[model samples]
Target: MFEYLTAGESHGPRLTAVIKSLPSGLEIEVDKINKELARRQHGYGRGQRMEIESDQVLINSGLRNKKTLASPLSMTIENRDWKNWKKIMEPLQLETEPQKLTNPRPGHADLAGALKYNQKDLRNILERASARETAARTAVGAIAKQFLAEFGIVVASHVIQIGNLKSESWSQLKQSANFDLDSKVEFENYFAQLDQSPLRCANSEQTKAMQKLIDSWQAKGDSVGGVFEIIVRGLPVGLGSHVHWDLKLESKLAAQLMAIQAIKGLEIGAGFEGASQPGSLVHDQIYYQPKTGFYRGSNQAGGIEGGISNGQNLLIKLAMKPIPTLAQALASVDMISKKAVSAAKERSDACAVPAASIVGEAVTAIVLAQLMTAKFGGDSLSEIKRNYQAYLKQLSEF
Candidate 1:
């Protein structure tokens, strides 16, 4: 039910997002959405764009008195830098023809998108392809996050690797600390503190090393990418179905997480590593207790088994490639001149792994919200909560 669409350009007047459906009576705070937007802009290696744009959501419709009305929610984030580009990016007629871009950047949509759309100017392809549109998705996800929180569901993420430097993953941290994986507050506190870190990494030594790596790469006119982990707590079992391929929870999460720009790889729990181990060692063994109901000693399955949630904290990891735009442009052939030329260099980050982690959290929240609404159908928040409580009772009795 939390389906949404986003539209905007990197340097356009504004970005827009429309959430098609949501339960009525869900309270939404504009400041919370703005907070998430600000979180997206934080992190080292960000470009001038972050400085130029202080993103905040402007609600257009589908809300009354800060509560949902079960209608479409429309929002916009004004691009403050649009003032400088108005002449070139004007929607209608212009007094003079704007300079057309012919060079396509490596590892970007410029070439393929232009070929598919039959456009000579690469800007036509790059504007929408830019990751700037994720700001709108972040705004939409902020609302979904609030809705999830009402049901005790929470989502968070932290960067684990940047360039050659690596830090502890969620599972690794739990094991090292002999942590209680079931403690929701501990999980929240741990990831919450990461927001203060420049790289959003837990290890101070690794964070410093990663920062140095980014600086080294930037000085060399290169870019770097890394990995992050996402954690979701307080999810109920059976939100997804085992009967359908598309209905599988991991499939849904993988599809959305991989769609984030620059994301090149994904792993759920012991993903690739588990494949190399024996089944006896890799599989999570089952256990039961009167207080906790069905449980597992390990989470190698990432909280989902047989395409349905297993009531454990959901774990996901994503790998982002180096940002395509670089200070030292790569060799490319100009589309118009049909001659070798340097790739286009846009204002970009030297490393964006920390920022991408926030986007990962937002996307994960959106997917879980969609599945939650699908599993417990209702038109209002109270109705959904009742259904959710009933489901918990059923699980307890089983």
Candidate 2:
């Protein structure tokens, strides 16, 4: 239903994206997409690139007068660092002024990627391999998030933990949150909200605690990880297919989540916790009523069961490991010397758990939008709206 590709290196001239098959006549908002790129650069532990780059979307194709033309949409987000790296990342041969990387971090794609590709310069591998690629993904996902908004569908995410001090669970916080779309409130429009507390939390008390915890651990020259949950509401059921392994909605979504940097694990409902419980206790009990279409006693399945959504909130939780680039660095062998060396350390974040959540939301939005279009395929916005309305009617009457 939806597919995207990204190009450019970690410190390349620009991060380029091409998103194909978005419905025609859908309004394109430059600010909305730029804001998403801005969000991706946020959180507690970001490096120097964030300082230099002021990401803005330059619409190259698939748009006319602020509307889609039913063609492959292309956008380029300029990397501010590109000016300095013009010679370094030039597509043409650079006379091999070797910027060779010898050390490979344990948790990164350094050594294995180079070995697999048979490349001497690890920069060749690490460029495409860097978390910097997420900029392209996040840019495209912002468009996906906009598409989701076309329906009453809403997707929101929040940080639950930073390191050992876990933040509050998503469902609970969402229940207590008060945001009026009419009023238009948004966080993460800035560069540094990572210290905004325990959950990278916007809440005052929690944000303060998270900041303290980060400061406490900063001295050890180590980084911390955190948990975040994404909730998709107003999604009609049956967006995924059980017919094919590749077509399964959960698998596609899980694969996207795992694609992020330092993201070690993902869970739908009970996730790992459900593994310890019996079937009777772990499975969500479905109940139908006049008020709600098909409600569940508990969402242990994380909104999808048997590879298809069951009309419940699509809840997905992810656990991110600390970033591999740390000041103290982990022990690793230098590829050139074949001797032990400390992991490469550039300017890195102290904690990126919060920023990771933003990426999680972005990635999930793209997946959900893809699934939505898969089930309700249409070329134009008007046609998609008609199909979506019919689907909603079917849902309501049932």
Candidate 3:
């Protein structure tokens, strides 16, 4: 199975990611991965960490001479602030008194995590639970995206809402999705454009509007959240299996989306909207032609049905909650003193919807690539190339 593991505290020496089961001979680029990290930090309402960290990945294992080794791939993203926090985050028993976190932030993993582990200092929970971990995840996801792009797929995301302001439609976004996916040059260009944009949105008007909404949130001295969407094209059929819950593509995709910081909800095409529809209208109607192997009239099922890809576009939506380091902290009991108090204060963004969209893109890429590797079944790029070419030939001939 395609898999990944992450380690390191939010304020520790560095973030680490180990990805396993990538096909060998697939080109792995450090610069490309770092670019994704840069994208994650570029949004309008980012916190001070963005200013402090310029994330760059250090590949340690599972790659040599720019290609996968088909083993576990390990990476490191050094925490620039680790030096200053070394004594505080030390794994060794502290010779001095550990900084105690009495107050816990509302809507965060702080208090619950500490209580579950039976810890007094909420800092033990909040340190590792911090959203900073998303930086490492984005690095790993970027590699997965590179794999998907090699197969003629295009995936990009954008912010659609901020606080109370929401956009109705981003019609211009539909124009940039053309794909002859699965190539070096195309993948480079595809991400290049996204890296250049402020909103990571294809539509200039929509991006400008998003910027204005962010400005409004910044003025409030409060935090907010918004809706974002990941749009993809050119995915083939049968990337996931319906036979098991763990194998369900949508379920796996949903889990990855929800795993990101501040993301509270996930939806696939016409997701919740299907609840109101009768079964007849909810599923896509099948069509076939001599030239076209199989097709769907509409994609309400989000390119997946029966837990597998059905040859249509994938549309995933992510709903991010407001950043939790609220300018006005919520009430909580102190872990050390056992007295009620305001939550610990931390520098945070007014909103992170746009940055979260970048995260969504990374995770979706990882899941999709994992499925593709599983279905195609190869440990090296040469084997994968032969199998993929044969499959494409079959599709074209059929």
Candidate 4:
């Protein structure tokens, strides 16, 4: 369930998303969806496009009286900037020749996309390739988040690194704190405070330094990129299967998270760092209690063991490369002219790690929602809840 697809382009009339499958009788809040869209635009180093567009989701089908109807849910987010580019972006033939972009940006899809589709204009390739498409995704993920909330599952993220500066990771922060990491209230409160921060980072001093780094680079006509972590809490022990490679939770997570624009790398828990540690140090030790059932003392495996969720908080880290568009563009050869030229410059952020963290939360929610639906397997929210409760009861008895 929760199968979906997004359509439309940056600067187009509107971005459209169709969620082809979802359970019935789930209540959805439009305001919450809009709130997520607003969060995606609030980061400190966002470009002028954030100012020009205030995104809102418009429901087109499969919903009535705020409840899902068990059909394909469709939504749209209008691009406020569409008015300015209507002439050049008309779907039908244009009355006059539209300007074509020949030079491709070095780190972007411009060159390869054009060559793949055999297009003369780079705009054709870039329109859909732009990260603007993530708005529709954020909307879909908002609904997925709502679904997860029904089961008491929460997904959140925070920026940990920007350029060369770094902040404590989730594991390190938990170790330094005196509170219980398993307490849902404590965990939620921590991330709630991060929502108020400009960089979505818990460390105030590091956030200020990160902002200074962004400012210095922007002044130099350069862009910056960094890393963020996604943390999921309240997952059951068996959402995925070990029988098939594709069914592994990590594989699903890596495939989806890596699909986000500008993302370059991914890590789960200790990940690459665990390579240098001995087996005894890197592996999480198992323990059993009558009240809590089976558990782990640490989560070096990132909440999954043998391709299934281990009822531990899921931890994932991702790396994003600098935005391809720059004030001083990189050198490139014009496809049509066959001469040296600077890459195309577009309105862009000096750094977007903060905004990307919000995106990470939304995306993580979507993947968990998918797995939950698969595990519970019901046509209605109430039915899924019944199945989930039964599973918990079974686990307790075991």
How well is each residue in 289-347 modelled by candidate 4, as lDDT tens digits?
88767778888999988899988899999999998899988999999989999999989
Candidates' C-alpha lDDT: 0.91, 0.78, 0.79, 0.92
Error of 4 at 332 (Å): 0.6
Tens-digit per-residue lDDT, 152-225, candidate 2: 67666777777777655644544555742222233222114433443456556666777777777777887777
Which lDDT tens digits does candidate 3 get at residues 202-240?
Answer: 556767777777677667656788888887777887778
Which candidate do you rate higher for TM-score, 3 or 4? 4
TM-score of each: 0.98, 0.90, 0.89, 0.99
lDDT of 1 by residue, 240-321 (tens): 8899999999899999999999999999999998999999988899887888676788889889889999888899999999
Task: Estimate the TM-score for candidate 2.
Answer: 0.90
Judged by lDDT against the true structure, how good is candidate 4? 0.92
For lDDT, candidate 2 versus 4, the one ahead is 4
User: How well does candidate 1 score on lDDT at residue 31?
Assistant: 99
Which of the two candidates, 3 or 4, achieves a greater lDDT against the reference? 4
**Candidate 2 — which residues are off by over 4 angstroms?**
172-199, 278-281
What is the C-alpha local distance difference test score of candidate 2? 0.78
Worst 10 contiguous positions by lDDT, candidate 1: 177-186
- The number of the candidate with the highest lDDT is 4
**Could you tell which candidate, 1 or 2, scores higher by lDDT?**
1
